[model samples]
Target: AARLRAAGEAAVARHLQGQVGRAHRVLMETPRMGRTEQFAEVVFAADQPEGQIVEAAITGVSGSQLVAG
Candidate 1:
């Protein structure tokens, strides 16, 4: 059903962000946990390079695409 699809998509997004959120919290030296896009720019631009080049792609279940250099 369309409703199930939406929930599934939302779950995927949550999972994707959950992983990133955990790591980001550690990096930022935070101690709380939850859905966070505080660093939305970083996640969305994780594939970009300022002085480097992206060499590979990483696919997240949330439909978020990542690139590695």
Candidate 2:
């Protein structure tokens, strides 16, 4: 599990870096106090203010997919 998680994270990092430029920050929000927080990982092009913000998704699992902004 740990190894799979690590590989998935690394894949996400690589995908984000390639698609959206270098990752700048990660933001999280809770829909409700008791609910799990949703996360957004933001990345931007070098010297540019605009880029893509991708929501958390598992990309390594058999049927999983990732969509970039």
Candidate 3:
């Protein structure tokens, strides 16, 4: 219950502290067969208390099919 606009820096820090714990990154590999492309690698991180993908970076052999979540 501190105000930021009235309190400044310290209040800002407290506000951000209310956020959830840091997420974890997990790399998932999917193999491709009969294709000239290499395996697909996706970097994902768990979200808040749910522990699901909230942020991600996906890249392939050709840098194609890249996606972020």
Candidate 4:
């Protein structure tokens, strides 16, 4: 019984290792496709003193200034 249990555990370990190797291969071969964070240099108009402020529901305010992530 002990030998059978050991054999079963070894088999499971081999299967898991094979699965991990396949997953690693897939990750390496797969093309990375995703939207990257977009950033731009913002320029404020001379007439506008406050410039532009984007307010979101998750945003918080500290005193009179808006805290950005």
TM-scores, all candidates, are 0.35, 0.31, 0.22, 0.31
Of the two candidates 3 and 4, the one with more favorable lDDT, higher being better, is 3
Top of the candidates by lDDT: 1
Q: 33-68 in candidate 2: lDDT tens per residue?
A: 110122333222222222323233322222122222
lDDT of each: 0.35, 0.33, 0.32, 0.28
For residues 1-69, write the lDDT of model 4, one tens digit per residue.
999998987775554333321211111111221111222112212222232333222122233222222
lDDT score at residue 46, model 4, on the 0-100 scale: 24
Clashing pairs in 4: none
Candidate 3 lDDT over 1-69, as tens digits, reads 357455775554443333224222433343221111232233223323232323333322223223323
Query: Which 10-residue window of candidate 3 scores lowest in summed lDDT?
Result: 31-40
Candidate 4 deviates by what RMSD? 21.4
Candidate 3, residue 39: how far the Cα is off, in Å: 34
lDDT of 2 at 25: 32
Pitting candidate 1 against candidate 3, the one with the higher TM-score is 1
What is the Cα-based lDDT of residue 54 in candidate 2? 29
Question: TM-score of the candidate numbered 4?
Answer: 0.31
Name the 10 consecutive residues with the lowest summed lDDT in model 1. Answer: 25-34
Clashing pairs in 3: none
